[model samples]
Every structure is written in C-alpha cells, then in structure tokens.
Target: MTFVITRPCCNDASCVSVCPVNCIHPTPEEPEFRTAEMLYIDPETCIDCGACVDACPVGAIFPDDELAEEDEPYLRLNADYYLDHEVDAGEPKPVRTPKLPEGEVHVAVVGAGPAAFYATEELVRHPSVHVDMFDRLPTPYGLVRAGVAPDHSATKSVERTFSSTARKKNFQYCLGVTVGEDITHDELTERYHAVVYASGASTDKRLGVDGESLPGSVAATDFVAWYNGHPDHADDAFDFSSARAVIVGNGNVALDVARILLTDPDDLASTDIAEHALDALRSSAVREVVILGRRSIADGAYTNSEFLSMRLVDGVDVVIDADDLELGDELARQVSEGSVDSTIGSKVRLAREYADHGAQGADKRFVFRYLTAPTRILGEDRVTGVRVVRNTFDADAGRIVPTEETSDIATGLVIRSIGYRGVAVDGLPFDDAAGVVPNDAGRVVGDDGVHVPGHYVAGWLKRGASGGIGTNRFCGQETASSLIADIIAGSLPAPTGSRDDVAGLLASRGVEPIDSTGWAAIDKAERDAGRASGRPRRKIVTVDGLRAAAGG
Candidate 1:
C-alpha cells in the first residue's frame, strides 16, 4: 500500500467524496458507516492518487512511506474491512432523493442536532413543506458543536450540510426555545400538521456505586461537553491534581476522553476546545489514564480503528497487559472457526502486540485493563480510589463472572463513560427501560401499542444511544416514511392555527425566536474570535454569550 488512512479518521467521510476510485468502505450512504468507528481506505482498490491526503481535516491520511511506526497497523486495518466483501466495480448509484409531500405542509421538529437536521433535510425536499425547528439552546447542531472532540475537526464539517438544509426556503429556526416549558405538546400539535422529536439522549449511564458523585468523580458526558464547550457544562471542573486517572468503560467515549487527556496542550491551542478546559489541562498533573473494560479483550466495544488511532497521538504510550490479550482458548477457537469476524478479532491480535512492545513508556501512558469491574468507588468527599473484583470470562455463559480475587487502584479521579440514555418527554409515552419513545417503526406508540397520532421520532429518541452520524439517515428516512404515510392516508390531524398564529403565540410569551440570519451572526462572531486566536472556531459557552453574539 503506497497510501493509508489511519487513527485520525473521525468518520467525516470527506475523503470518500474526494477519492477518484471510491475505495473507502461504508461511505456514510452504506449501513455499516453508522457503526464503524472510523473510515478506511480499501487497499485493494486505492489508485494512490493521494487525494485523500489533502482532504483529511485531521491529517489522518498519509502515504505508506511516511506512516508513523505506531500507525503502520492501519494499512492492514483498512484492508481488513474489505476481506469479506467485494470491491466496488464502479461509482455507486447516486443516492435516491426522498419522496416528500406534494403540497404546502408545516411540521415542527423539536431539536436541532444531526437527527433533527437529517429529518429536516428530508422534509424540505418538497419545496412546499416548511419546517420549524426548536432547540433549547440558542445555538444548534447539538453534539457536533459541543460533543465531538475538538481535535476531530473533520467530523464537524457535516454541519455545513445542515446549514444548507436550514437555509432552504420556508425553513424556520426557533433557537432558545424549550419544549414543554415555553410551549407544550398540545400547543405544537394544534399549530402544526405533525410534530417530530429528535432530542438526543442527554444523560450518562451511572456506575451506581458509592462515591460516584464525589468531587473527583465525573461523567464522560460532562467532561466532553466541558471541553467542547456545551453551555450546560461550561463551568464544570475536573480534578486533575493526581498523577493517575481511572475511566470505568472501554467504549469509544472512553477512548475519546483518553485521547483528549493525553493530547499535548499546544496541540489543542488551535482547535475549538473551550478556553476553560484548555487552561485546566495546561496546569494538570495527570500522566496516566487507565481504561477499564468490563469484558474480555474479544468483547471490547471500541472499534479496532479507534484502538490503532490512539497510539499515533504524540505524547501518550498505550499498553495492554500481556495476560489480558491472551484469547483464552475459547475466543481463539471462535476466531479460527470464522465465527468471529476479523474486525473484532483484530483488536485482540493488535492489543497483544502493544502489550508485548508499547510498555517502554512515554511522557504519558494509556493502559487498558480487561475482565475487570469496579465493585465500589472508595472514598467520602473525594474519590481516593476504586475497589475492583477480578472477573473471569465464562465462555459458555457468555458473560463475565466475579472471582474471589480483588484489587485496589489508588486514584484521585474516576470518570464513568458507560453509555448515554434519553430522558422522557412530558407528553410522549416513554419506555424507561430502553430510554426511548415508545414507537413501532417510526410512529410514536403508546405503552398499549396504539399509535399516538401525528407524533413521530428519529435518532436517539427513536432508538437507543448507539451508532454514529450515518445511522441517523436510516432513522430520518423511516420517520419520514411513517409521517408521509399518515399524511397521504389523511390520518394526520388538521392544523387549528397558522404560522402567523404560532409566531404571535411566541410574541405573546415574550420569547424571541432566533432565525437563520441571527444564527449566522453567532457563527460569524465565533469565527471572528477564532481568527484572533488562530483557532478554527471559538465557541460561546454561555446562553447569554450566545444570545449577545447572535445579536439578540
């Protein structure tokens, strides 16, 4: 391979559009892209034109001759994706445009993240269907702006597509508008033909042990938001006075947190990380991050591409304990039997290589601990350490079982990155068990399995929190199908009011809706501020700051 795509590929898929050969698998149009940790350039078909090298925003692509020794494995990782599938013979058929309603229609989409944006983009395909988007924050593009790691600038580029969707004629944005607080479900239902909810999962999974709320313990959700400048967590502080930190989950979120912690402060200076987080990192004492996996190496949830990417960051040395990498007979048999796919098997194989060689050490160390579970977080006012019990892989049972052995790791900070869950919407029937709106397909259904007329959902609210950006396309399409079916069947409720009336209602409540033009001012101000600092963009992290910047 003369060229390769490596660890810094943040799934933006920009390179796919640039490549003349279209060798990248799961080009965001394919289903696998949603679940993939990162994109890979298929070694079998790449023409070595090196168009990807210039297109990669994070500098993730490089000719094989210039590949970092730590990232040499990606040459195989990229090739591995095509092992089970045939290479594309030619360009894929252009994506099919969604069939939208034929006449003037008004829809209210509550949220302005990727899911809502995707749904909105589809709704506006019909020139006559106008969409009004409402989000709680003055700024939109929920996670893209405030949840993605600052270093992953490529992924943020997807927002430009959303901006185009927003600018579509007749589309309106009502930022700083809170659902249920300022306007109730009944109010939206009365004014619009259909109401769609795309508010993403907002809460983090809990460790559910003692001292979880200690000053030193935090959620990866807040940590990410704090660094990426989420308004709700802009003032939050993390304890970095200790030399060692413990992250309780081994998923991609944990990987992202680890990368941010170990990346050199100077490297973050030109990124969009909030000033507060950058300042805290500059004065930090943390040198080691221990990511604890509750399952065996074969069961690790993070993608192999992410595992390889972490090694390429300049300051961190990542090590996997030698004993943990051993496939332990059963998993090895599965790999040999072809019961286990190569994408997953690669993690165990390459992890063993890191365990065998990466321990020489560097300025910072990132270590992985498999088959370990934290039984309790030990301490009172602050997290002093965690008490963990050894877990044995019960291959037949397909679960991790507790053993008599125990271990204690002394650490000042513990960050939980288990998962994310959605909160209940006031009027919608929510399945607390799944943290999702009770739905059949895309139509919001009640607990008794009866459809809630005109109510629909997309993205994390429709499904659980999982998958990446591409996943939302599936959801947006499904919800659009359901809503369009209802509209065609004449089953949708007739709107009792007009756009003027809805605007009048907001005026009566003294709520000023920020339109697309106002949002442009905020975007411009943030970029102008970034220009002064020589960064990509400087985020406004307060609701007041956002309002002022938007010329409110």
Candidate 2:
C-alpha cells in the first residue's frame, strides 16, 4: 500500500529530497508550494520505499493501511491529488555535501529559527564544522512558535525537524540571549570564523492612517504573536468583544485572524492556542469579519491554496461580493497576456463560486472587500470605525491610486495586516526601504560595495519577509556555500580556540546560556502540560516560565 501525507506536513519539503522517485505534488519549485495546506503524495507513483515517512519531521506520512481511522480521509486526499494532476516520477539527484576545510570550523548563527536551523543542518553536513546558535527567546524555532497561527498546527510541526537539527554533532544552542545585547558583534567575530544572521522581520508595516494608535486598533503581527503566546506580546490585550472586526489586509495573516476570531472555541481545545487567547476567543462577541484588500486578485500577495483553505474552515462561511469577484479589464488583460498564471484565475473562480453561493445559514461569516484602502481609524480613545477610500489600479505605476470616493466600515476593532519589516541589527548593514540586510545572494553587503568580512545572512533577514519554511533551505544552502567558499579562500580568519573557551567567556560575562538538553526539558514540560488538557503543547509565554521549564 502507498503512503499518504497527512495534516502535519508543515510544508518543509525535506521528504522530496530523500525520495528516490519523486511522488510529492506541489514541490517548492511550483507555485502550489506557497499556499498548499499540506503537500500530498501521489499514490499512483508510490514505490513505498518509505523514505518520505522517515524524512517527515511531524510523522504526517503513513502507509495507506496503517493510517488511523480518523485520518482515512488523508489516504483519499493523497490519491485524489494524482487523479486530477500530472505526476513526474523523476529520479533523484545524487546527494552532495559541501567541501569543507581540514580543521574544525566554528560558526555562530544568530536567531535559532527555521533559517538558522536549515543553515545549521547544512554546516553540520561537514564533520569538521560546528555551529553555535543564539536567540533572544528561551525557546527555539522562532516564528514557528510565535508567528504561525496556532490553529494551523500542521504548519507548526516543522519544529520537529528543527529539534532533530539541534541534536546533530557539534551543534550548540544558547537560548535567552540576544547577540547585540548579551554578546557584541566584535565578541562573536573574535570567537568564530563566520556568523549567519537569520533574525526575522520583527515588526509589521503600519496602516499609515490617522488613529491607528487607537486602543482597538492593532498590528496583525502583534495580534498574531499575542495569540500564539509570544513572550514579547504576552501581556497584550485585544477587544474581541466587538461584534464585528475589520481587517485591513487580505493576505494569509488576515485570513488566519478572521478564521480564528470566527472559529468555534470547541475546535481549538485540541490545538495549541495560548490559554489567554483561547479564553478571549471563546468569549468574543465577534461574528462577522470584514477583510479589506487595497489591490485586486491579480496583485494580491496571498495564493489560491490559501483562498481555498478559507472555505474549508468548519462552520464559518466566506462572503465574496459579486463586484469584488468581477475582475477588472486590466487584470483580465494581464491574465490573458500571460503576465500572471492560472493561479489568479483559480482564485477568481473560487471567489465567484462563493459569491454565487452565499453563506448557508452559518452563524459566523467573513466578507472580503477588495480595491479599498483604509483612510483612517474612526475613534476617540478606542476604535469606533474605519474610513476607507476606493482604490483604482494604476497599471502604469504598478500601484493602487486612491480615488475621490470615500467610505466607512463601522467596527470597534481595526487590524492592519499590510506586511512585515525586519528590525535593524546593530552592526549589520540594512536597507531601510527593503527592510532587509543589504546582501548580494547571501553575503552581507556594506555601503562601500564590499562584502562584510565573515558576515552573512539568510531567511527573512537576507530577503524581505516572504516565502515559506522550505524556502529557507535553499537560502541557507547558498549562505552556507558562500561561507564555505570564503573559508576555503582563506578570507575568513578562524577563531582563537574552540567552544570551551567561548563557553567560559560567556560564563565569566554572566551570560547563562540554555543548552539543547535544557531545551529538551522545556519541550517535555510543554508537551506534558498539553497532554493534561488534550491539546498539542501548552506554550510557555513568559521568560521566567520558559527558563523554569528549561531547568535553568
């Protein structure tokens, strides 16, 4: 029997590399990888070598006969992917590890997130190279724990892969430490040959509207972090008691917020949503959510898979206005001229279908309003409503130009989910406009048009905040390759000594680093607490709590 990829895929795509015969659909190379809820295996092309089963970090794959009774639908899901789509059973390429230097290599990776883990994985492939990862949080796997929507449990399972990466030989984790604060750039440069910064975009783009600072108005990033139990946002509060909430963006984050606000609290009992957030959602008076997008379907950042995913939310209904679903002449021309793929067409079709078939007596609903930009949040102290202007697409300028027409959506809460931008690193050169560290490929670029010696970047910090988890794999490889090439060229000077010296130095400086073993204890504590409540893992949202759980 063939294997099926179940819900916990998390879209890491590690399985694709290990399979001798490629059977997974919507690989990272394809557009489908962006929004696919989870990757599906083509049962028709399955040789059952069991490589995918082993590579899957979340244990999402199972032999057709071995699937639990509740997961029987996934068997069909896997088979159905093949029924409608073409399969390419291409042979796998030979596994290649980077050529390394003779002696031991030491690298310090700032930010113990997906990109850092992927880079760590790449570095450890060479037996001589060792990696010491640093992060501000006591926990590892940065945004996988704090940014991803908790209801999307499958997406969060990528942490399992990272946990495995932490166990590799010569791998070290120094949690609850900020690089610029606890350890300076000069210190790291003196201690290691190279440093790879995977520090993610920590802030969200503003709505740029007046009254955005109203108590009822919040950034989607903060809201996301708050709901996911991030320590930084642990004490943040939201006015979910509002009857209707308005979201001023239509990306995946907007969709996630709408889904979470409207979802039945009973469903989240099995998920890992923060306890306070869970209570907030359960007590929420919100029943209708309005998601506003300034751009048309053709230019929107979210993909077809995400649009389709919205329709699958249990009990919640999607409301697509007929006018919004109707594509403009410019968008239609772009689609016909092949400027964009059929993905937009698929999204337009789904919108039309939902518009045609209105909400079927569902208590909760989400209304998607396109081509509208928020002008201001209407409020005195807290948000009372939002004023928006009709936006006309300026194809020539490739921007949305505001029209004279203005309107208002009455709601107590307004959430801006426009986008995210990275925080500035102390010594790293940052391009403020792009909100990323200036880099050519993966090498950090300085104002003098020279590569920053022994400095590199990967993930969102290298590029602006975009792409999924697997996207970091390629990015990490490129940065790792560059670092390796630099080492071979003898450009990057080695550290004075090994990690023992560095460890002692940290101790003398009063920096108490949390090692991988301590992290494992924290993991067990979280899981154990979650088991008591029949949930995934009850997250530790405070620094003290996490440290205690980590046995600090």
lDDT (C-alpha, whole model) for all candidates: 0.83, 0.81
lDDT (0-100) at residue 44 of candidate 2?
A: 71
Candidate 2, poorest ten consecutive residues by summed lDDT: 338-347
In model 1, what is the error at residue 46, expressed in angstroms? 6.1
Q: Highest TM-score among the candidates is held by which one?
A: 1
TM-score of each: 0.91, 0.89
Model 2 spans with C-alpha error above 4 angstroms? 1-11, 21-54, 58-89, 333-340, 394-399, 496-498
* Candidate 2 backbone collisions, by pair: none
**Cα miss at 140, model 2 (Å)?**
0.1
How big is the positional error of residue 401 in model 1, measured in Å on the Cα after superposition?
A: 0.6
